[model samples]
Target: MMELAHGNEVYTWPGEAFPLGASVKQNGVNFSLYSKDATRVTLHLFASADAASPQHSFELNPSIHKRGHYWFIFVGNIGHGQVYGFQVDGPWLPEKGLRFDKDKVLIDPYSQAICFGRNYSRERAIGPGRNMDASMKSIVVDQSDFDWQDVMAPRHSLNDTVIYEMHVGGFTKHPSSGVDKGKRGTFAGIIDKIPYLKEMGVTAVELMPVQQFDVNDAPQGRQNYWGYSPINFFAVHAGYSVENDPLAAINEFKTLVRELHRADIEVILDVVFNHTAEGDENGPTFCFKGLQNGAYYITDKETGNYANYSGCGNTCNANHSVLRRMIIDALHFWVTEMHVDGFRFDLASVLARDSNGHPMKEPPLLWTIDTDPILCSTKIIAEAWDAAGLYQVGSFIGDRWNEWNGKYRDDIRAFWRGDSGTVSRFASRVLGSPDI
Candidate 1:
């Protein structure tokens, strides 16, 4: 804390921009957040995950810490496990498409791990007043501390892969799962059942979204159990973690990957980059919606409402420069840091849409992922369609990408039911369907 003339103490230093997230350095933690229209940004530090209010809050000095659209700050003496969040002040003009509320404590867009208390509520973040107690806090993590023991992605080719798609939660969620009580429905549960997966002779496990998603994203009483409603792209789901600590999820997820690789089993995540848990303009002010709604989501130019291409209410502005870079960076982290083999993009065709929600002939983001040096060897698989009827099974942009083959599924189903004229299509599907 720097002592001011008035005897108030403020802990802060000018931070850099290259590393976007909360980077744990030798001296302290460096936090950098991107906010193009925000007039003011404050860094709030808390003592614990359930801290009702921040112990210390320091406003970023624009002249010193602001670099273009980024508001960054380096705080001394704070290391890993430090709970933090951001508060941005700007115009609340919905018509012009800028929604910033200083009252809402937002999780960092680049947060590797997120922590929420019992009082966390999506309703509290919707309208007015400060939701500090109800807000999700971002934790500072030192990713370099994990010991993989020379473990790496199995790198199983798409041609030789027999993918077994499974849900992480349901894999062990049942009472008859035979997994230990505490370990049930968790990453450790998957580790326990490695023998079974090995016996099945599957090369790759296409995991349904393990990314930190909103469990409360379902209907009035139901819960989002599939993990499709993602809140943080980089974070491992806290519900899957055995421990309450925010860092435990990351470490446990790594342990799952390491153990899977030991058995020569490749891990492929069914990533949901198409839409966030934040539903629409009426949804809660989460990370992306509150940070830069216009930059992150594909908004209707006239209504300023979100374009629902993914049928998830808000379609991500995937082709935009900011989001495109973020998608690549997130993938690189999962590959280089998390040691994941590949990705199966949910609603992969959404990535093909332009800002106006129209399909592009050559989507830059798709081609960029195909040619990216970091992602070149990484298996790129696509669901090959969106909820908006943008199918790209045969016409998907990149040559490296393997499609889900929706036509193959239909044809195979038809043949099983002895449908007429299905023989030719079924044969084509068996031979990799050149006409699909």
Candidate 2:
């Protein structure tokens, strides 16, 4: 038997921060979060994903749970599939660049599975008041539960790569897709179409943003079809899962990857690390904004407003030490846990900027990612430009990074459109743009 502190029948213990997310240990679940300036942090536990209120709440004592920049707690009798969220308290002065609202429940930045309800409303999260019933919750999932059945990554070299970039939902959502109504537009649907991909001689499928994104993040009358507005970097999109259960997305996603690997096909996720579904100043409060706004985002030096280098109303502070570690940790999770082959960064140029929004000659985030031991063998690709017109085509620092070759597309289009005497430029593009 293990000793545990019980207050009103809520058992708790101190947790470490080596693993940042909520981890299911042998005895209980360890919850950890990074908040630099937070004075107090509270953990809320719910009976279900869509519970209207918390079943139990524990406010972590700073002396016991606080260590450095991380706040953590180990709750006894809580294991896998437990639904939880955090409420952080601090100064709410937005003009000073601090937007901490203790009432807004926040998803864990390191969550492996996210639980969203049909009635989930981002609008209710923007201002004060508790929004537990209307907000998204994080589910504690065991990362080691899946059985790979001796499957491994294809790990095809970049020189021999034949990438077929496509969207996950659009691949089979249409009636012309000829898939079963229930399996259409799901990870299982992709498994149903693997034969066609094999016949086409494609080596890898560049999945366009499988990370959990906001479907309602569009104009009032439209939907976000491309999935550029991501909400959680760690969880697979719940919309692509079959059953409404919390574990369905995680297991089905792993099944898709394992099945693809069996056919000698590689999986590359197109990740958007620049901006999130949470947009500018008027945007809703999610995980990062509520936990630590000044650390997660790039703000104006004088007015403290968001610096929109990503053209998405706000830019992520990718080079910050904390965010950089989170990026690397997310990459390791996909590569080691999910067995993903590579990553194609959307608006990757924004990652090269300094905290002040200026481009860096040697961005620490890029250098760290390039040199990280776990990611050294993984393929890293970049779009090579940002919405702010900061382009780094041939000048991108990392030697291991492959670019999308935007110039080649432009030259090819110009030559085909008969714009001018562009034979030399077109030929160079045909020759892989060595002139670049």
TM-scores of all predicted structures: 0.95, 0.95
Q: How many collisions per candidate?
A: 0, 0
For model 1, the local distance difference test gives 0.87
In candidate 2 the C-alpha lDDT for residue 209 amounts to 91
Q: Which residue window of length 10 is worst by lDDT in model 1? A: 1-10
- Model 2 segments more than 4 A misplaced: 1-10, 244-246, 414-422
- For all candidates in order, the CA lDDT equals 0.87, 0.87
Q: Among all windows of ten consecutive residues in candidate 2, which has the lowest summed lDDT?
A: 1-10
How many Å off is the CA of 360 in candidate 1? 1.2
Mind sharing the TM-score for model 2?
Answer: 0.95
How well is each residue in 370-393 modelled by candidate 2, as lDDT tens digits? 888888777889999999999988
